[model samples]
Target: MDFSFLPKYWAYFNYGVMVTIMISVCVVFFGTIIGILVALAKRSNIKILEWLVSLYVWIFRGTPMVVQIMIAFTWMQFSGLPTISFGVLDIDLTRVVPGIIIISLNSGAYISEIVRAGIEAVPKGQMEAAYSLGIKPINTMRYVILPQAIKNILPALGNEFITIIKDSSLLQTIGVMELWNGAQSVATATYIPVEPLLFAAFYYLMVTSAMSGLLKLLEGRMSNGGKA
Candidate 1:
């Protein structure tokens, strides 16, 4: 097929790439925070807290992300967003709120398990040793356990970052002009479906491949007797 369509919409493609990257960064940042909280909650001594976190993880991880996005979009459209009467500083939360919330909640569910596993991988003696020195649990986790857990989980987090890039395309369904959405728009406008899609696929390949290489390098660094 002719990829002649690429040049015509190069600007649009660039915008799509930026939007994709922007949304993915937001998702990863918020998702990681939510995941850490969920992971800690799951291990909490309170039965109610653990049960609530478990339910959240179950619902988010069990359902399809597309469905969640669709539902979130529908809900936002009906409810609209909060309005501020500030002069030139009013925030429009409607457009982005649904997408960010849905994607982060979904990603957080998966990341929670990854984080839980990483933390668990550390030996129990580490905590015992910290406690033996009269260390507070929070300080013990922050200074000792979490540092090791982060090292172990860095590769998985990188993988999740790559996954978020691809998955952000789902936001296109809600009329977000992300990479796939740009391609779909191009295909419809140009009447050349395959090539525009292929062009978008090329960008996705480049992004994911680059992230994979970076993850491998990080893994090597972390594995070399913790040198890096």
Candidate 2:
């Protein structure tokens, strides 16, 4: 209940917040790219590609993310990833890399289904019209299908981003120095575990709430024909 430790350890919590946002952003970016590709492949009408993508989605979705993170961490440790410097920031690939990869892959599996649903929701006539005009299949998809499908997919993508923000806390288990991990560090240093965790909960609530509000606004604009 004593939060006198805040002044001493607030910086650590702030750093944790930064790491959480960084990881979630990276996961969402990479996951969306992977999801779009996988969704397109599943819709390709190619049996082998469809089967392979289905198996991938099945495995990632069926298994626990924590287990995946642990396995990825151990594998990356064995193989080793190089640390890279971004200006003054030294990114420890050994820690962040595994978490990013695992979480992005996990998110991609789920997002693929959402993307597929969105793509399918697009009118078949739109695709046929593009093809009748001598457009290549890829071009038809790129110019005609995806743009329309994106409107349907945007809300789900927002929800996925929210999910990733919370799930990034799991990276703390592998010493990724995210929000939950920062709270743990503060707890150990201050011997006031509950307060630090409460701080993390508050921070998380603020972030998710802000994101949810933005998403609702965007959805409203889209629903209203992009009117402000």
Please report, in order, the local distance difference test score of every candidate based on alpha carbons: 0.87, 0.91
Candidate 2, residues 1-228: lDDT per residue as tens digits?
Answer: 799988988888888888888889999999999999999999888999999999999999999999999999998886667877655345678989999999999999999999999999999999999999999999999999998898999999999999999999999888888889989999998888698999899999999999999999988888788443
Over 4 Å off, model 2:
82-90, 224-228
What are the candidates' C-alpha RMSDs? Answer: 3.6, 1.8
Which 10 consecutive residues of model 2 have the lowest summed lDDT?
A: 83-92
Residue-level lDDT for 19 in candidate 1: 75
Looking at model 1, the pairs that clash are none
In model 2, state the lDDT of residue 53: 92
**What tens digits encode model 1's per-residue C-alpha lDDT throughout 118-208?**
9999999999999999999989988999889998789889989999999999888888777898889999998987988988999999988
lDDT, candidate 1, residue 92? 39
Query: Which ten contiguous residues of candidate 1 have the minimum total lDDT?
Result: 83-92
Q: How many residue pairs clash in model 1?
A: 0
- C-alpha lDDT of residue 155 in model 2: 93
